[model samples]
Target: MTDTLLNEICALETALQQSQVRNDRIRLDGLLHESFEEIGRSGRHYCKATVLQDLSHALKAWHSAASRRMRRESAAAHSPQD
Candidate 1:
């Protein structure tokens, strides 16, 4: 493979990872082709749109849950009942 093609593949891989971390659906959509699809482990199929939709909700829920836990920990650390 040409170095240019290899570099682009690497860049796309990095972009995919970054998009997942940040839940940036726009970037993810751009990276994927129009006809990309995945057959999930449960025998279900997910298209780009479905993946983006699910991740949007999943990421928000994960952040909110993590934030709540952090707040609880902070409050506990500051509480007088040691």
Candidate 2:
């Protein structure tokens, strides 16, 4: 179960990265939802605290990336050089 959870986390990270590359908001949201669901299901038979912690960390990473992207776009829009 731990291995499964780890694999799921890795898959979610990959999907997130791919979505980021394509700027696919819908796909990214879906992937995030699926990741949460998987974490919840896996928590039933695994270390609940650890699984939740991992999920939280994943969410934070995603949010951080999103925030950075938004900041970059905003900066570009306001740049006088552009």
Candidate 3:
């Protein structure tokens, strides 16, 4: 690919990664094609819908875990020292 095309592709990839990390569903929806499909390394098939669903679930789990950690730390910080 030409340098300009290569740069554009790289930029799109970086944008995709950032969107996923930030859980920006709107951005993802815009970036991914409706018929997008991926065959994972394990040979599992995933479509656009499946990928988005997985990301949503993962984001929920991550937030839950982070909240729990924050609560534990807060409790420990407030508790009297031994």
Candidate 4:
């Protein structure tokens, strides 16, 4: 691909990542094509609609896990020596 096309693709990829991180569903809808499809590692298939629907649930679980991990680390950091 030419440099200009490559740059555009890179920028779109960056936007998609940012949207996923931020859970920006509207932006994701705009970025993703209606015909998008994915074959996940588990051999399950997902399409654009399913992915958008699942994103909220996935992000919530991720946030909750991260929060718990941080709390554990913080408690460890603040624990008194034996």
Give all TM-scores, in the order shown: 0.68, 0.42, 0.77, 0.58
Give lDDT tens digits, candidate 2, residues 1-82.
6999999989878766663533554454454443344334445542434444655677789899999999999999999992
Q: Compose the digit string of candidate 4's lDDT tens values, residues 5-80.
A: 9999999988866745438777888888999998989999989999888987887898999999999999999999
* Clashing pairs counted in every model: 0, 0, 0, 0
**Quick one: ranking by lDDT, best first?**
4, 3, 1, 2
Give the per-residue lDDT digits (tens) of candidate 1, residues 1-82.
Answer: 9999999999887877774543777777787788989897899998888888897898889899999999999999999983
- The TM-score, computed over Cα atoms with residue i paired to residue i, of candidate 4 is 0.58
Model 3 per-residue lDDT tens digits across residues 40-78: 999999888988898789889989999999999999999
- The stretch of ten residues in a row with the least summed lDDT in candidate 3 is 17-26
Whole-model Cα lDDT per candidate?
Answer: 0.83, 0.62, 0.85, 0.85
Q: Pairs clashing in candidate 4? A: none
Candidate 1 C-alpha error for residue 11, in Å? 5.1
Stretches off by above 4 angstroms in model 1 are 1-22
Clashes of 3: 0
Error of 2 at 5 (Å): 26
Clashing pairs in 1: none
Clashing pairs in 3: none
Q: Which candidate, 2 or 3, would have the higher TM-score against the true structure?
A: 3
